[model samples]
Target: MLDDFMTRATLAGIGVAFAAAPLGSFVVWRRMAYFGDATAHAAILGVALALALELSIFAGAMAVALAMALTVSALSGRGYAMDTLLGVLAHSALAFGLVAVSFLSGIRIDLMAYLFGDILAVSRGDLGVIWSGAALVVGLIGWRWSRLLTSTLSPDMAHAAGINPRHEQLILTLALAITVAVAIKVVGVLLIAAMLIVPAAAARPLARTPEAMALIAAGIGAASALVGLRAAYVLDTPAGPSIVCVAATAFALTGLYSVARKAR
Candidate 1:
């Protein structure tokens, strides 16, 4: 299996899931799903820029995602609903990126690959990038765990405890950007936010606390990666979306169990 392309794909998916779990919990708790989606969508623009400039796709994605996150944060109270703002920015970026990609001459760009991911095509170097980026996300979250939770609970309470909620939000923004960058190879831009949100949602019914939710989400995410990859191999489907299908299946099952438990 070590010599197989599927092995690298599995490892890459697993790395992305573990990093996304905790970040996804915060996205769910803070109601930043739209923000996450907007940023992920903006990655298409990053891909265009990377190809144009001959730079690393990861670096380009991280830079663009960070810019998108910061732009959203700066526009938070500017007399517009967050959803409305994100919707405009997200779709606009995607449209422009697609147009830009169409203009690239002399290169056969497989737009579907970037949009939906080419996980089975991941190489050893890509695995190194995925795992390294995953480690960075985990370490950053662990360092700011308490502060972030406190801020999520209440900005006023965070202030009373000398924690700036905005700063914590920015920290999460940074982490989110990094996640999108690394995850581009594994799940691509279109499904990146799903990777962030689905496992956390699935884990919620089984968890009793914030910490438990994070750990459970990670386990759910890892399971989705493993199961989804095997299923994709067996069924001849797209690996990235298959992983999401597994996570969505988990979410459906957990939701049903929660409802049944409540009825009983």
Candidate 2:
């Protein structure tokens, strides 16, 4: 029974890591870490809504994340600094979500589990949601890969080639929303951004191209999930944080290697 439980948990974690890595590569490349955080922070509101309305948690998060992404994208065009707006939105949404969650009476919800994650508690149904959502996100990204790469390199160039940067941005925003929704259940809202960023960051120094970075990031994320799971089982530690720690350690090692290569 214990073995079966562990197997399911590991499989779920692996699926999540695979999905998070490629999307996260773009998040890192586009410097959208803060945007991811803002969307994730808003998930608490989604959770609250889900519980109150008896809706699917995934659906609730997707709705909230999409709304938040649209709001940020619209506000980004208003001549304000993106970082400033993101900071305000991220923290404000997190604070508001916390307060909103507190209003639920007669229910004992472990806020920490939602914030930091409870990967071991993932159900088979949740795994199905994660895999399906991830596949959709990957397909969308694949369809627009060239356009996105062009836009990332130079929006002017992309425009000259007749690729609409705005449309690509919208597509990316949608993908980010889906990614946040799926990943929240794996790493929780507070740490979801880390899972998105750290593996990609670790892969950056080792990659010569964007595609290479994405693949490397996926590998790193998968390895981290496996290793972290083992460590968690052995040490009786929390799974989510253990996974993130492994990613962080990989990032540190990569950074060191990059520095050494630079010096040589």
* CA lDDT, every model vs. true structure: 0.94, 0.86
Candidate 2 residue pairs in clash (backbone atoms < 3 Å): none
Error of 1 at 253 (Å): 0.6
Stretches of candidate 1 off by over 4 Å are none
Q: Candidate 2 lDDT, tens digit per residue, 1-264? A: 324757767776777777778788888878989998898888888888877777988888888888888899999969889999999988888888888888888777888888988888887788788888888887888899999999988999999999998899899889888887888877899888888899999999999999999889989988998999899999999999999999999999999999999999
TM of each candidate vs. truth: 0.98, 0.96
For model 1, residues 1-264, the per-residue Cα lDDT tens digits are 657998888899999998999999999999899999999999999999999999998999999999999999999899999899999999998898899899888877889989999999999988888999999999999999999999999999999999999999999999999999999988999999999999999999999999999999999999999999999989999999999999999999999999999999
Model 1, global lDDT: 0.94
| Candidate number of the best lDDT | 1
Best by TM-score: 1
